[model samples]
Target: MADPSNYTYPSPLEGYEGLEPLPDEKETEGPNAKAFINPPSKTLSKAYNQFADPITNDTRGGFDIHIYYLQTNASELKFAAELHERIRREFPELRIYRLFEGPVGPHPIAMFEVNVFTPQQFGAFVAWLVINRGPLSVLVHPNTGDDVRDHSQRATWMGQPIPLQIGFLKEMLKRKEQEGQTNGS
Candidate 1:
C-alpha cells in the first residue's frame, strides 16, 4: 500500500510525447521569464452561459455553502444556529442541512452545508449571504465529481478560506481506486 502522507501522484501534464519540460524554477527568473507569458483569453459561448443543469442526472452539480463559526464561542454558536434557521426559512426550496457543532466530513470547523440546485438559486443565496452573513466564514464549493479540485481549486470563499481536511477526501478516493483494482484483478 502507498504511504498516504508522502505519496505524490504523477503530474497532470505528464504523458504528452512531444511536449518539452519547462525550465527549472531557478532558471525562470526576473522580468523576461517564461512564467511571465501572457495567458490566453477566456471566451464563453452564449450557449455555454445558457446551459441548464441536468435535473435527471444523479451527478447534478451544486454548491455546498458551508457557514463556519467557532463552536467554543457560545454567542457565535447561537448566531450560527439562528442564521441557519433564517436561511432555511428564506430558501424553502433549497436543501439546508442541520447545523453541525463540530467538524464533519472534510470540513475542519463547525459548519452547516446548504445545497443550491440551480444557478438562479445559487445567485439568490449568494446575494442574501452578502448582506446577512455576519462574523462567520463561508466556504462555497461545487460538487463536480473531481473532489480535490472542487474542494481546493474551484472553491469560492465569502470570508477566509478555512482549510478543509482534503487529505481525508484524497485517501477515500485512493481506497476506492484500490478496491476497484483488486476487484478487477
Candidate 2:
C-alpha cells in the first residue's frame, strides 16, 4: 500500500479501500500472558467473570476481536452513538463491545474488543469493515506495540470499550476488597 489515502484505484480492480481484510492477528507462545493484555490503565482495570476460548478458528468456537483506534480528535459523543446505532441497524446480529459511556473516556478513544460467536457473524463483521470504515482507514494497531494475530487480541477498531476488560477490571477490584477485609479480620 503506497499511502493509506491512496484509495482511488487505477483500473477496474486495481485497488479498493475498505475491501481489504483487516486481519485479527495474535501470538501466544511460552505462556506469555501478554496475549491477554489487561486494561492498560490501572484506573481502567477492574474484574468480572467470563471465558475466552484458547483457540480461535473455524471450529464452532467464538472469535474475540480487539479494535485499536482513536476517534477523530474531539469527536462528539452523539456522533459515535449514532454510528453505533447505524451499525446495529445494518448488522443487528453482531454483538458489539462498547468502550464509551458519556462524552469522554467512555467514547473509546483507543480500542474496543468484540466477540463473534458464529462464522456468519464473523462474515457480517468483515462486510461491516467495508461498509463502515473501508475508505481512507488508517492502519489500526494495538497499544501493546505488537500486531496480534489471534483471538488473544480482539482487533476490531470501532473505538468502543471491550466488555471483558471492563468485567475483569471490576472483578479484580472486588477480589482485592474482599482480600483486604479478610486480612483485616
Alpha carbon lDDT of each predicted model: 0.75, 0.43
- Give the top-scoring candidate (lDDT): 1
TM-score per model over all chains = 0.66, 0.35
Tens digits of per-residue lDDT, candidate 2, 1-185, equal 12335233256544445564544444466676336533334452121121223333343335544444445544543444555567667766656657544222222245444455555666667566646642222122222212132212423444333333433444655787799999995
Candidate 1 local lDDT, 76-101, one digit each (tens): 89989999989988898888888888
RMSD of 1: 9.3
In TM-score terms, candidate 2 sits at 0.35
Off by over 4 Å in 1: 1-61, 177-185
TM-score result, candidate 1: 0.66
Compute the lDDT for candidate 1: 0.75
Residue 24, candidate 2: alpha-carbon lDDT: 49
